[model samples]
Target chain A: MAVTRPGGPVDGSSPDAVSIAVPERASTGPVVARALRLLEAFSDERPTLTLSEISRRSGVPLSTAHRLVAALETWGAVERDPAGRYQVGLRLWEVGALAPRGPGLRERALPYLEDLCAVTRENVQLAVREDDEIVYVERLAGTQAVGVHIRVGGRWAMTATGVGLVLLAHAPPDVVERVLEGPFTRHTPWTLTDPARIRETLAAVRTRGYAVSERQITSDATSVAAPVRDATGEVVAALSVVAHHGNPPVSVLAPLVRTSAGGVSHALAAGRRPRRPR
Target chain B: MAVTRPGGPVDGSSPDAVSIAVPERASTGPVVARALRLLEAFSDERPTLTLSEISRRSGVPLSTAHRLVAALETWGAVERDPAGRYQVGLRLWEVGALAPRGPGLRERALPYLEDLCAVTRENVQLAVREDDEIVYVERLAGTQAVGVHIRVGGRWAMTATGVGLVLLAHAPPDVVERVLEGPFTRHTPWTLTDPARIRETLAAVRTRGYAVSERQITSDATSVAAPVRDATGEVVAALSVVAHHGNPPVSVLAPLVRTSAGGVSHALAAGRRPRRPR
Candidate 1:
């Protein structure tokens, strides 16, 4: 049975990655690729796996899987669960947290995101465009937030979220075109699926410097988002606040989000966290 | 000039990792170990590197480094910046976020951590024991927090901070013995160095259900920490709130921190996030 899948892999299928041929000889390139593919075999659902399960999922032979896993364990890349199943290790998380696009961005934007969440008491999200999809970098749900829950590293289509739309509007020509080519998954009736409407929405986001997405995921929730730029004036990421619709209205939230996004952009450009008075 | 080193590696010296004889042939295990060593070469101080830098740091030859880097880049283990220097990639970050000890613990403990930071307006830190050290899982700084800045995955000695003391108190016997056999580094005059005092402090923490570290890290800061246990009642993590020493006194902060830690423990026991009200 298919198990250990969480929304699926963001970098594409692991099986295809593991299919790189290994010569009858010892080649470090193909072997390293296979080992990395084994890492891709893990997901939110399948956080832990037995040796056979790992071998099956990664397509690495059982003997090689054993040896590769041993080496990874030695380096703290994978840890054994209580049931003796392999799980991702803390050290790997430490190394990955160095990624400039993920935790590095989150570190700079968190203070502003916290401010947005506090002001609106709503769900605050920060995301960056990756290919035709958007990957959430940070998500803070307030104590009284609406029914909006987003996972860090969760991927969604550019048309499905306010931050996604803002990122989509500033995305490269090919990325914009690819996103506009529809087969969009609809979450609610209010989710934008029509290519023409989405195209118009993108244009408006560019003109207004913000995007408003209402009832896209839930009927009670509405989102207002703004773009975050780098020193190069790039739409590196997008920030959004999701709250109950018509409670405060989108106009009131847009300026707050835009200002916070701008603050984050400034911090990113300055390359230092803004110190607060103690 | 030994550049691009963070507080140094957590697992051990990584040059030893690369010295894993890459047989005159192609051995996948040793090669994968070498590539992982390249990852260890990156730190907070050096998040990006040129190809020559990577080769020099990882102890891998230039030609082999190029091929290995290519394979790694294909799998999104590393990425190239606009300047063509290599950095940790977002896809690797996404995969690493799946580590239960890191993001999973952080996700479960965050709401309570937010509540603590909000209530005390201080810095709240969560940590878990790894080997002979304590690895921080999360740190939230309140707007009015005191001067405490702990990186999410930063490691420290088991006797340095409140959370560290709490974790150290409950660690396995062999681990405790190793920590007690001192060559202890002292940070401040008040920082505990006497093994007898440290042992007594550990005993007191067990009896009190919490720990107090006053001016251990900074002259103005004091941290009160409590243990977070799983359903099995095993101490899996430590939660601490750091603030200006004796402002509200440890008497006031102790119960609050202990309660928050209990809530986190209950949440971990249930294995589901406590639902928040709207």
Candidate 2:
């Protein structure tokens, strides 16, 4: 949850070396940047698309999308399906596994995450904060667990889900204020919409060391979550468990979430965490 | 996997488009290709690197590495770590999740994968064949279980792991022949390097509907695996459970792997399989 990349140099120069050539103000200078955005347009909801579809989604012209997508395919960033639609490529996945905030975080929390699912027989999830939303990195589903739409690398509002709340509670004040400013997606009647109520819930999470969310993302689910910290004591992620509503009090799940979170923290500090070998 | 891309149009372009782009090969084509190669230099083991390290590893000149890293960072394929080293970026991971053989496979197998972990309390893994190697798509750890270094999106030799054996068994004959003919990586004393012995193991896996690898990768661990099929009844993935070598009888874990693999096959056929939502 703590990962944030500062803007770096745009030209191929030293970190301290500024660009001298005329800066292209129109955002069309680097071919690679355009290529990445085209790839980004394909998300969990829209993993496959036709040529024109990608062009429209990425706001690149058909000619440019053609060129960029070709470059991407050469590097194995984009692949085509049997239906001749394009999706992300395996090569990109191989490289993405190197990202510390994504698979790196998942590797560390996995054992404890599994234990939480086994002990509670509920859906266990791990997420990191990206901007104002939380991106799920890993999840373990119980056979009888309630349905959830969240997927690994999928995004959800920071005010609705249990992991989102825990991460947001520990987020900076500016981020909290930004989320309180509106455009919340309402999934169930129980989902908090009032900024004041969410503020109170954040304070409660800080006081109790966990967050309880009832039917916030789905009508039949309840979630409990706790913050996971790194070696420097910074909250880096959140571990959560979602179960069927009315099955047990959210308080029953608090201990499992907290213990798993602490276990993940210890694993991270011990450097025995799961990681894709280089 | 018979998933090779044609050499002409690296993008999702028609053959006609390839004919039109023949002239540009004389110009700055190396820049884009070199940049892609630079990004490829980062891996699970070498997640962070300095400028000279990247140049040395990618075999690109210092100026080229400088230019390419700048292009990558501008496009968010890479980012600078706090200590001024370069690391893979989150944007890359987001796009990588679109790989049909990577997270795409994991999404469909996650529920069944979780069940396998819960019932066995052993390390559960889901993997697909990538070239001659097995690329792990998902791995669910067990609490107090045997320790392992495998993580999601990691790769291992086809002759050295239970999942690898299942995949090699179901692969086309040519794929099998190619693997057996090449030099193999032997991780431990139990790793099968002799072509004849590996052929016998593959045959056994096919006949029994499961695979048992004893201390193949690690001396203290044993793994049992089964094949997962798609609607076409093609062996698209393999599921495995790694445990302490002497803890569970191979006979006991065999049925567990088959049963779980069966559930996953049924789910895939139904098209309602639980997966990462993307």
Candidate 3:
């Protein structure tokens, strides 16, 4: 699993990229970072953990984990279930929902995404590039649509999905190079593994104003994706609809996806306001 | 503004209830708790803040705030924007989305929520009780529907909204009592301020299996809400739809709201799995 910090370099030296690279070695950062490491231990695979399990996974001492967990529990950053296992808390989610690049983007794109889902009756997704990876901000599963492995807040590689290709197309050159230098995992027989071929796909996404992923993630599904630009015309996100392959040609879905993406872009542009620097 | 900790008490002592009652005095809890206080400083009103602003709001010294912010930035719990102001990071949202009482519940209930929104063509919301307050987990705005002040991850008093009434009706006695002890801020002239009336409303909610908040939050809008239960029959969340008042009487909306709530309850019951006690 490649750890990519989404919003480019946080500082001049890109301290986030460095810290995420070596998460287990705790001697380099402050106590707060060590406590945050405990949070990182809980993921989709492991949503809940006991104190000792948290300590083991976070590489913190049992006593330290206990104290930190207590603090987290007190602040509503974490909570204990009926069986005394700690999980992320709703308060933390409320705070996290304020993230401009995450729920904020999802909130704005949701109506258009809903429209797409309603019209196509297919899986509609909105995603953004985080480092070299794609983080799904919102995924609306159509009632009659094929099942997808993607979930809100889930991450995927840049080489395997339509939204990923659209995002990678507009990403920085360094980000593209870093993604291309990958130990890419193939999900299906049609999954592209060659960097040259992936690069060509990205170019096509930029040229055609949309990307079509044919049975790349699963043998039964295909995705059509378009870029969502911000007020500054930067491709901040990608909107896509995944349907059962061969039922509707890519051309059939392309215009709808592009129009939906354009709606989101226009909304973003209209809603863009000057942020007052503190 | 009132500060409420959602999700009841995590510890036997219920330190969260006490700590949130006084968020400014940070000298009382662990260092990690103090650090989380900084996060509490960022809200819908002030989504981004400078280090000095955080220090001022959280009552942490400038140096301590700097160190903790850096730690948060390194761990992607917080990020500095282009103007050197700190905001909640996408990584935090990803972790927070794993909260069962938050996004987990929302994820299971979304399809039904969408259905409710599509059928009603009104604003639909899903929320859970966090202590004595309501934390909106998801909200879908209907096209051509009346504007709503609520946003995803936003909070409201348990006495003023339909979802809040449903959640409060099923809340523990202590939680209810604590909420009634409040100096409730009236959003509109119709907003209930008397504790006795609010208590009666809660009782009605429990009896009827639904709640109708008429012109409480806004003079022109009405909300009908019902409780969503988990596998153990615990009312873990509330579902509601806000519409223009008088157009659809509360009776007309109650059955639809209740049906949507039942759908989510059934989904949750079906998805329930035995947990491994840690």
Query: What is residue B203's positional error in candidate 2, in angstroms?
Result: 7.1
Candidate 2 backbone overlaps, count: 7
Model 2 earns a TM-score of: 0.74
lDDT of 2 at A248: 64
Error (Å) of candidate 3 at residue A239 is: 2.1
* Better by TM-score, candidate 3 or 1: 1
Winning model by DockQ = 1
Estimate every model's Cα lDDT from 0 to 1. Answer: 0.81, 0.78, 0.81
What C-alpha lDDT does candidate 3 achieve relative to the native structure? 0.81
Q: What does fnat come to for each candidate?
A: 0.54, 0.48, 0.49
Q: For residues A163-186, write the lDDT of model 1, one tens digit per residue.
A: 999999998888888878878888
Better of 2 and 3 by TM-score: 3
All candidates: CA RMSD in angstroms? 9.5, 8.8, 10.5
Model 1: pairs clashing at backbone N, Cα or C within 3 Å: A4-A46, A26-B26
What lDDT would candidate 1 get against the real structure?
Answer: 0.81
